[model samples]
Target: MVDSLSELMIILNRTYKEGNVFKKVVKQIPEVEAAKIGEISKRISKAKQTVFEATAHLDRQVWQETKTSAQQGRIAAEATRKTAHDIRARVIDLQQETSEGHDKLSSQVDQFRSQMVDAADQMGDQLAQTKRQITKDGEERKQFEAGLQRLVDALPASIHEQLQSALYQFVADAIVQRQLFALPSNIISPNSPPLPLVQYAQVLSESDIINLLQTPDPIGDADRILRKESLMSDEALGYATLLRQKRQFKEWLSSDWPSLVLVDGCSRGESVGRTSPMSFFTASFASTLIRAETGIVLQFFCGHHIDPQKENSGPKGLLRSIISQLILYPKSYNLSLNFVDQGLYDAVAASNTEALCYFFEKLFWQIQPDTIIYVLIDSVSDFESDLHDYGERMDRVLILFQTLIGQVLQGFAAGPKLKLFMTSPNRSHRLIYRVDQAKESIRLNAAALGDISRSGERSLREIRRARSPLSYIM
Candidate 1:
């Protein structure tokens, strides 16, 4: 029993010792945990310090960024202020310019309105003046018409009828002629009295004689004749002589009384050729006189053909052409007054030589005083000279012209100034002699013409030499 008790005591003692060891292990575990906790606390403190330092650095960086941001914002605000100021300045300038432009436009509009008003006023004044003038013209026209009616009523019925018919026919012919020649019809006023023949004549200008002649173009004929004769050159002596003669002819034209100029081509001691320089000269001169528009120029170009049917080539043709020209003459006062001359009309229509002579004589008397009449007879030698009674016929023509010339020389105070220009070949010596009795005569010769030509050539050569480059260089 005592042994069992001692083993129990030993077991109890070992249990106690094991309990103390567990307690000490428990205590050591706590110390080890405390040490580890201290190390962890130190590590946590270091980490916290590092975290605070990093936070401070971050705060500093954030503050610097905020300050930089504020500076940039300030700088942006300044730039924006400057930009706003510039915008305001630009807006002010634009408004000022707009105001100036509006003011200028308004001023221009006002000036234009004033000009328009002035123009309207001037236009109204001009219109009023025109109306007044038109009224005055109407009164004068009525008075003139009343006087014309009174004069017409005083005439015998038969005479009035004849006058009316003649006037109507004349007016119709004038209108027809105007249309045919493409002449302006403005002279014939639609409102004017149809029988105002004198007034109409005054309004109408004398036109080209070709309108009446109805012959081949005389100007072209003249040019052709001149070219064919080789007398077209101005430097030629013959042409020069002819020019002198033309000037003399123009001088004769200035004479107050009836004068005759006879150009004898055969005086140059040449045969009675178909064409002569004198013929061309006469034709061209007649054309020039007609163009002068100073007087009545009647021309008869006796073409080479002497067919009686061709009235422009014979004596009958001459009378017909002259009468037609006279009919167209601007001096229509006497013609209109004495237009009832049936004999003259019949003679013209029939183409009778004797009747034409009588008609021409009567018509010649009817020409207004101070009026100039030019009769140009070119190539008179071609007047039926082949016939047996050529001299007799030519003498008759000569007598007719001489009678008219003599009448003019007798100084009928109321007669027109007449000038007769004739070109003839020396084939008819008697005819030439009769013409030579005239106040003016031109006799052309080959020798004199040759001398003049040689002198002209020498002069031309000298002139050329003077103008030459070689002469200038020398």
Candidate 2:
């Protein structure tokens, strides 16, 4: 019994030691110095950023609770938009007045010409008197009479030609010369009395057009179509800009066009494309007014004949490539037609202004053109935008287009080297041209004529072949 008791007590002691030790271990966590140090290290830099972000979040919440800043933003943008719209309208008004002035000036030229011709009779009489006074004997008188006859035969047809010769004679006579006319500041400032579209519409009228047309004019069988651009209709507006690069071009040429002759597109490292560069250089050098010779041609494929369906990319690339070729080989160069999609159509269709801006940013620099041209064709039968009827202007569409033009114009303002040329897509788009708070009719008299073809055919035949007596129009 003593041995069994001793064995039982030893077994009980062993079980207690194993079970109690395991319980102690399960109840407590072991300490680690390395883990502590690592966790402390987290507070060094990365954690500092988190702390800063948290503090910023807290500060933002406090500011949102305490302060008001609703009107600060978009202040400049609103002002800018208002200014632009105002300027656009003003430009149109001024341009119309300027056109009238041009017509008046042309008429004045004709009257001036008549006066000069009238003075020719007086000049003949003076010559006869002078000839008689200079004659000494029969032989001298005969020669003087012959010279006077020659003078009568050699009378100039144009007043300008006469004045030029007269000026030469005055110079020979040692007479002090002065200009006869001093043009008004309005005559010279194309940008003056600048009115926005709203301001222009407020004052413009049919009377203005009639008055402008009354100025002295040459007789022409064809009724002239006044070319104009529709600023409000553009969906995407593209502007190409080039600074005074002639200075750099000069510097480049001095270095034998080393930097000017690059070949690569993406991987090009400070190298100019030789083929295009060469052609550009050759033509430019020949054409530049650097010396006595004026090297460029005056003709333009100025007419619009581009296929609407074509992207204008292939044609543009081909045109550029040909120019490059011409540069590679020096010769007399003339660009028969300027491919002028420039950017209006594309910018209008762009999903956002950012795309349009980025597009023009490169394009403007690449073409380095002196004049920018915009062409839009309007057909009565053409499909209208899904949002508007054929004759109506949609405000939403206008707003979108206005936004685009604003962006493009801002790009242009940054670089005035680019002069924008724009054309309305169609004469039938009276929605854009008719005078009201919205449409300015002077830019287009077509709308005033009214729709002759109910079927949307704009041809003369459509009017002449009208099935109804009421369809006839002048």
Top-scoring candidate (TM-score):
1
Candidate 1 segments exceeding 4 Å error:
1-254, 267-274, 309-312, 329-334, 337-347, 384-390, 425-427, 436-438, 453-474
lDDT for position 298 in model 1: 78
Question: What clash count goes with each model?
Answer: 1, 26
Instruction: Give per-residue CA lDDT, model 2, range 18-128, as digits (tens).
Output: 546523323433345335434455545566788899999999998886554445446767898999999999999999999999999999999999999989989999999
Q: In model 1, what are the clashing residue pairs, if there are any?
A: 311-317
Q: Compose the digit string of candidate 1's lDDT tens values, residues 1-474.
A: 344446445544543444465222332444654565566667667777999999999999999999999999999999999999999999999999999999999999999999999999999999999999999999999999999999999988999999989999999988644333331232221222122223222322223223433444444655555444332333322433433535455567566777887766654233225555555556556656666666787776664546755555567666666766676656534252233234434444555566556556656665655677888877677774656444455566667777767665885334567788877655445666776544467655555555565655554354233321112111
Candidate with top lDDT is: 1
Off by over 4 Å in 2: 1-71, 133-474
Candidate 1 lDDT for residue 262 = 70
